[model samples]
Target chain A: MIPDDALVTATWDDLIERDGQALALSGNDVSLLSELATAAVLFCAEGDATVSAIAAHLEELFGAPEGADTSAAVREVLTTLQNRGVVSITG
Target chain B: MPWESGTAFRVLIVDAGNQGRSAVGERLLRRHLALNGIPADVIRVTSAGLNADDGLRMDVGAAAQVERLGGNAHGFRTRSVSAAMVEAATMLICGTWWEREELCIRYPRARGRAFTLSEIAHLYEELAVAAPIFDHPRLLDSRLRSSEVPDDFDLPPWEEFEERIVAVCDAIDEATRWIAEIWASMVPHHPQPKADGEEAAEPTCTLDAFGVAVAITCGGSAHEALSIAGKRAWGRCVVEDREAEADLTIVVDPDPDVLADARLTGALAYQDVDTALHHLSSAVTVRAIEARVGQLIMMHAAGLAGPDGSVVGFVAPSGTGKTTLSRTLGAHYGYVTDETLAVAPDLTVLPYAKPLSVIDALTHVKEQWGADSLDLAPLPDAPLRLTRLVILDRRENGPSTPVLTRLGHLEGIAMLAEQLSYLSKIPGQLHALSDLVDAVGGLSLLTYRDVKTVLPLMPVLLAGSRR
Candidate 1:
């Protein structure tokens, strides 16, 4: 779970900016835990909405799907994200 | 010495006095060898005459050698040995240089004959550079005249002599190309020994860019495949051939001086292998990933591109009508890439609507678009460019609607950064990424349920094109 707030997006070669000016990020910008967690999040929360929305809409989306364990997948992603500090709650 | 007489090789060491840097270079070479599963005894050639801590180390064995004498192969000089000799030796060991006049000529009887030809041309070129006398023999001093040649033939017209000089240069170039081909062939060449007996142990390269798992396999042709994958992933790869079971092997020689070293041996093909890896990992693949992530971050969480630079991009996330809509649009635009879109810095989403990789052939994208209609060509050579970006969202039993939202600078840049794979500790990455987002016009395009619903909005995105 890349920090929704901390995550800064840009084009392939675009310079990062803060307050209309270019900003610099060093080696400290990356968190190993977050990168791994983000993978989990993408795999889990990819179908229809954001990570938070997936957590809320889990039953509605995957409850009826044959052989679906939406809750477990969401929990796995949440645990990974929570451990990495990208998410606030585990449930 | 006679045992290895036919074996020609060269040792090049530049600025070897720089102990720390040289040591680093040596370690890099060793690591490269191990990564590529090259079997050769590592022999460091540090003579007693030179300082032990600060002398050069040369790897020698049954396998070939490509070592950098100095930083630059073309211009390094040694007190005991000539640069030309070292370069020749390297070429021989690497087994890349060969005859040019006879294209199919394999290893000739002479060890350093190919490089000698190069040197001969170089000498002539050097003379021509110093004085245009070769081109204009009339300018030659009488003292420099060769007695072996008749005076009438010795001093020809400037144009005629210039033509002769050009021909020599062409010959040299032709030889270089021939040698390059021989060397390049070694990269993928292997002796097919009936595919019997013990299969050679698979050489594996495990490169962890931070945590990005890059597993490179080296075998008969797996090394090539691994290289291709690494190139796609924007990771470094190298191949070192043992010249035995593995005629061509990819090794991760991360030594900064490997290029310089390979030059010493005249291993043009080996050098080219590294050069190709460098180009793929650093330049092309990195740019592709950046573009993919950029489209994600800056635009309305949508992938867009016009195949053949014509139609609009059908932007949508996974499970959205994006793929279904893309298939329809691909018919018109020619499908640049299916999964990703290359949004250039100038605010154009280059379509990558290549062959739709349909897991379930029965899906709407595969069914309506039909397998034949999709462009299945690989992305590298595929045709497409961005004319418009149409974001998609599925609405069951509802008409497809197109809505555009302005994606500003920071927001857009943030979105694109999500897909950056090569975020190594490079200084320029942050700034370069930001600049890219600003250059591309970012927007969020909303899509309705039906794939065809997004068709009308294609012309609208094209209108923003400054192209």
Candidate 2:
């Protein structure tokens, strides 16, 4: 579930890149996110990124696959990041 | 991480008298270090004996042999062996088999390293054939540890009885050259080709700080300053070679196209080695902290661990007397760091023994000093753990006696999150942090007017009391 206010996130540069995967670190927690998932977390790390904005950006970057609902897809990505404490969805 | 040789290749040769076989070996090994472009000041080659006459001149034969080998033994003096000599020696070479046996029996710690001169020559011959020795820089220092002592190592054998007055003297001379060759092959000279009438460039030193391996190379004043810095500040972290891929390269006035493959490079352009060192300190610290991004949960705190490896992390923001308190606490407990204290998920504390950046009262500039320089206690041999967390609250006229009040999970987590680095990289970090707080019996806010006030509470806090 994505929240309303700002996303508390670390920069892309801070992510630990290993074996073709980027690991987002938060103290004791180390979350290995997929390329698509990493993109959503980084895009939201800009502080004011909304769910709709992230979906549109991802759709434009990777291209929406034949009228796919990317807004729903983006929500799932953000929810995973939220669950991992990679980013906080604060209202 | 593999163990790094923090100290220089300190070779201490022993015999019946320091003047003869041991003296010859010392002079030759010094030549070896010099030819390999390793500064004599950075590396140590000295001799001592169990039954030695202190302040005696080098043996007449040994002195003549040293000169014959193109080395001056004018200043060579004999001294009886001390425990400190045996303890500090990276390689303990004995002229006789009996010396090795006696040396080990007296100093049990040196048992791993104690070797006969003949034994070393034989090991070098065996190791030289095994080309993989080049890949293992520390194996030369550690082969004694891994390999068992030969069964007949205690049996005395003389190579040349009729030729030399002392039976072992001939073998010592022959074996000394071999020892030098082994050192030369291990630490090859710097790539800078010697120009006409110019000496070869000094060798590079690998430093291990906060789990980061940094290789430093430079010439002139920079090299001189770094040599002193390497010994004083990062003495315990200096290794023989770049065994692991270096995390960062600290080069001063480096030739372009040199060290191109390094992951991170901090190059010093100017020849001002003194000023460059101040900047170098900053670079090492920044890179060291960055290297632990995924592995360590680092806090911008000062850590002091008890003798039992129980670490009490004094979590505070910069300029909150963390550094000041560290000096006081360090005298009592093992000082980990005054800057960043990184911990594993299992609560194990990783040592970041960075030079303490202390502010000079008169100069008002932060001077970087090794933990030893400040008379701080060294980290205990035991494995360190984050047993307690103290959120320091320092204010004028706060309390004469420190107050340790527990904070609830919500406030504690928020405060803790502020002091942490790269939180987004960790999965389930917040809950883990909350669990850590609970495990430590809740984060305690220590309100005190003076640094001394907080000292009394360490015993209570480390005891893990709920109050």
Candidate 3:
């Protein structure tokens, strides 16, 4: 699991949200992701915050759907963002 | 009928030197006129400053010029002409940029009449390259003159500034090309008169890019311009032996530092070259009627495409962290406008992705992404397709998880109302603003304290949201 303190810096061109849908710009490319992933991506800037803390915060604020594997989902999303260099996992 | 039609008018830009640059600019002007196919009576005034004359007469002179142009002839006074003739021609009127602080204080009317600080900056650029002030070709480098530097700034090391200046010359040429394109789009050839009876007189356009009428007499000094703040400019008259009347005029105290910053690489000044071309478009002689237009929706902000073809948009009010958020997206998502997203007559949103303004406060992005990765260029270069409007807000709380809220069209309209320029304008502008709102979805994004908070949600947002 990536520590919340990990500094994840990326260059984006634009950010768009329509109806419940959203898109993000990173360099010249665009990515379509779920709202949960959207929240997770933004959370990458939290220093020393754990994935669970990030997820819990999101759940409380956005009222994420209950009964889903929130931690697992957060982990999965963070790992993907890690691979893309949009975020980093740190102690 | 995008804007109210204007009267017939003309402008002449003469450089002190480098006939080549002047020639290039003149050619573009002519091409623009031809493309518009508007018939206008134009004459060139080749002299420099408040004096000197190169007699190129036009059909309209004196009173006719005053009626059509301005009532005064200060704009037309030439050093070559007699003072009596100059006065008779009303040639000593103040042009827009000629002002002093004291004059403005003594004359409150001058406060808002002069050109904007930004506009004046742009005008200096046009004049600097328009003609050589002197007979010599001096390289004007932006890097050497910043507000921090001295007035008579020494030129920077040759190799450093040389490449950038050359690039600027090329960029200027490109801007002229873009101007030609806009002219072609706006001007239609006057229809030939019917074979049977008398032909109709086609009206001409007379406004500049800023939406101000070209015939409005811009004040002579900054103070005077400000004195008439918010008032329509007075018109100018042409004198037979003097310079052509200038609707607007600008003068500046040469500041090497300011000049240097303006010439910086990847600066907006580079793009100003292109914007000036738009003003020239308004003068196209093919159609004599001027169009009063202020808005130029440079690009669409939504419907951005992902690597896999998914699309989204980044929305935020001006000065919001929209650009910061955008540049942070990096290679992950496609970008649109940092300012506006031009929506087509159809529902589709076009992107106007331009350079993102990274402020001094946001240091983390630079730390994470190497500085080179963050180097942004001006707007003319960045273009993207938009999918949605993600309005970003700065919340004291750290980056929040993305919230997917749905808004009705009416609600969307309400949210978008704040985005248009000049809400106080006529009913027509208001209608256009409302129409734009109906076309796009709306969202309220509260930014968290940490960048990490938003990183986890990228893939899902890229994938699209569910109701």
Candidate 4:
């Protein structure tokens, strides 16, 4: 199962409430989060998955098609959210 | 050579020297191109003087004249025409016939390419008369390629300089139709064009071209939408940065699950990027950004600057007729920003020439329009300084003329505080505002019904501020 501390339940709720509302984001951040959202959805589906497992899944789905570094992108997003205290990182 | 590549078309305006007629022509030509929906990156415009003292700034009078005609007169510096400039020019427009002859003599290769402004205008007119249906750029190309050099008209008197500039601009405007057509033809078509009514799949966002840098954190699709919105609203201020050290950080968390939880704290969160954008738009995002920037910097009242670099800020709440007065005063004065006037601690005004937002009658929604689109004059190339603050107390059927009364700094700050963006956020905001009041020296109470009634009092108001 996903770590209890790992899920950003409260922040996610607030974000959903504010959706379709007037909020602004930089173009880059928007793209980054969108990428993360796709990966996060997949990660959550597995019920119990490590960050490495999620990164590997993302690589398989997006890496070759987009010629992107999925691992770095995933790490960055997770770290950013963790730093902001929006999500707790539990190994 | 650049034009030959089919990627970009370069037009060089040649004059006797830089900073005078040709400089003005360059600005006018660029304005006409922009008005016609021609992007600057595609068709590059530059000016050069035959005998220019390179690096000299454009003449203030000429710059002001360009501004009056709704063309930007900022960032202009004189430069002598060079062989490279002549060689690169797909079309060489001379300010006068004399300049054309000089170009032909100095650079023989430019002979077939060079044409006086009037000559180009005449050619455009002749082409239009002949075919009538042909586009502007094709006709322009036909004229430029032709061996014939049309004769020039007699130069107008010095006193009729403004009139002459207007006439030249009119001619250029006539020619730009084809210029735009040619530019459109050259644009590379996207491999996969978006279907009608289809929302962009990916999020693309840029900083407002005319506004401050905003760090946007949102999903992909939202980013793309913001990019489109930013272009439409902010012009060229959009930037790309994953890590933005911005004045304001806008966090967009559009996940329904994330937003449903009540435990969210810290950054402002949105349900999705679209909702966040919607909120920002309705909230007047540009104003919000400006207000936020003011917290970091110094914020002043909205207004225009005179030729002497002195700004006249109109302080009033929304729906109090500030826009109407700004529009009216803009015609006669150097048009500064209509919404927020951002100043350095030194009191120098920064140019935030965002499109003026006017309320649409049918939808009752505020629509943004470029300064050129509204026929508003551009701000002159001068260091803008805050000189006067006018507190607008617009009353219907109250007075036939505007009554001007001076207010103490305390009253001015109190009045100004209401209109200030993010006043509470700025550290030492009161002291900064007080310093600004001292620098400009008090405020004027402009009580009036109609803008026309206040027109005659502008000079008096400006003069009174100097005392």
C-alpha TM-scores of all predictions: 0.31, 0.46, 0.30, 0.38
In candidate 4, which residue ranges exceed 4 Å CA deviation? A1-91, B1-205, B208-211, B215-230, B236-244, B247-300, B424-429, B460-467
What's the true lDDT of residue B421 in model 3?
Answer: 26
Q: Per-residue lDDT for B432 in model 2?
A: 61
Residue-pair clashes per candidate: 52, 12, 147, 44
Fnat values, one per model, are 0.32, 0.03, 0.00, 0.00
Q: Is candidate 2 or candidate 4 better by lDDT?
A: 2
In the range B1-467, model 4's lDDT, one tens digit per residue, is: 10113444578888886777688778877875554344565568899998889888888877777787778889999988888898677678887778888898888656556777767666644332111111123334344554354555554666997777666545544454344332332222111234589563322453441234444433332445544554565453345653333322233445544532211221223445443443343223332343344343333245776777777778755445666777788788776766556666776666665556566789865565555666666676787776777888888776887788887555556566545544433455556666677777777788888898877776765553486
Ranking by TM-score: 2, 4, 1, 3
Candidate 1 vs 2: which has more DockQ = 1
lDDT of 2 at B392: 83
Off by over 4 Å in 2: A1-91, B1-203, B240-242, B245-266, B269-274, B465-467
For A19-40, candidate 1 gives per-residue lDDT tens digits of: 5333223221222223333433
User: Stretches of candidate 3 above 4 Å error?
Assistant: A1-91, B1-304, B308-310, B360-385, B407-409, B422-447, B463-467
Instruction: Give me the candidate number with maximum lDDT.
Output: 2
Interface DockQ per candidate: 0.12, 0.02, 0.01, 0.01
Q: What is each predicted model's overall lDDT from 0 to 1?
A: 0.33, 0.63, 0.35, 0.55
Off by over 4 Å in 1: A1-15, A18-91, B1-321, B343-353, B359-399, B423-430
Better of 1 and 3 by TM-score: 1
Q: lDDT tens digits, residues B108-210, model 3?
A: 2222222212232333333222111110011121211222322211234457755543443343334444433333323322222344675422211133211
Q: Rank the candidates by lDDT, best first.
A: 2, 4, 3, 1
Model 4, residue B249: distance off in Å is 11
Model 2 TM-score?
0.46
